[model samples]
Target: MNITVKLFATFRAGRFDIESRTYAEGTTVGDVVRELNLSEKELGIMLVNSRHVKLDHRLEEGDTLSLFPLLGGG
Candidate 1:
């Protein structure tokens, strides 16, 4: 399955803003996070196909996954 990943905020550091990658069926959002060496504790909002979803949510082909880090500014 092909999934489009979009990283926002600090998550894009040393990474890309958007990229398409292939994953096995039944792959969850958490899997991608781990693959990218991202820390779950720093994760803020998550969306799949523009709908809010959980980390364990399974992904489908052609799905667009967006990851955002917890914002910190005062």
Candidate 2:
């Protein structure tokens, strides 16, 4: 299946703001995270097709996944 991933804030540094990636069936959000070389601790909010989802959530074809890092500023 193919999904679009959107990275926000510092997550976009050295990476793309948005990109389309292909995954096998039954792929979970965590699988995508790992493929992106991102740790679970670096994940703040996750959304699949505009709905909040857990790392274990399964992805569907044509779904858009958005990942945000935990933000902090003085």
In order, what is each prediction's RMSD in angstroms?
0.8, 1.1
Candidate 2 lDDT over 1-74, as tens digits, reads: 99999999888888899999999999999998898888788789999999999999999999999999986668
**Cα lDDT computed for each candidate against the true fold:** 0.97, 0.93
* Per-residue C-alpha lDDT of model 1 across residues 1-74, encoded as one tens digit per residue: 99999999899999999999999999999999999999999999999999999999999999999999998779
Measured on C-alpha atoms, candidate 1 has an lDDT of 0.97
Question: For model 2, which pairs clash?
Answer: none
Each prediction's TM-score versus the true structure: 0.95, 0.92
Clashes of each: 0, 0
In candidate 1, list every pair of residues with a backbone clash: none
Q: In angstroms, how far off is 57's CA in candidate 1?
A: 0.2
Q: What is the lDDT of residue 11 in candidate 1?
A: 94
State the TM-score for model 2.
0.92
Q: By TM-score, who's the top model here?
A: 1
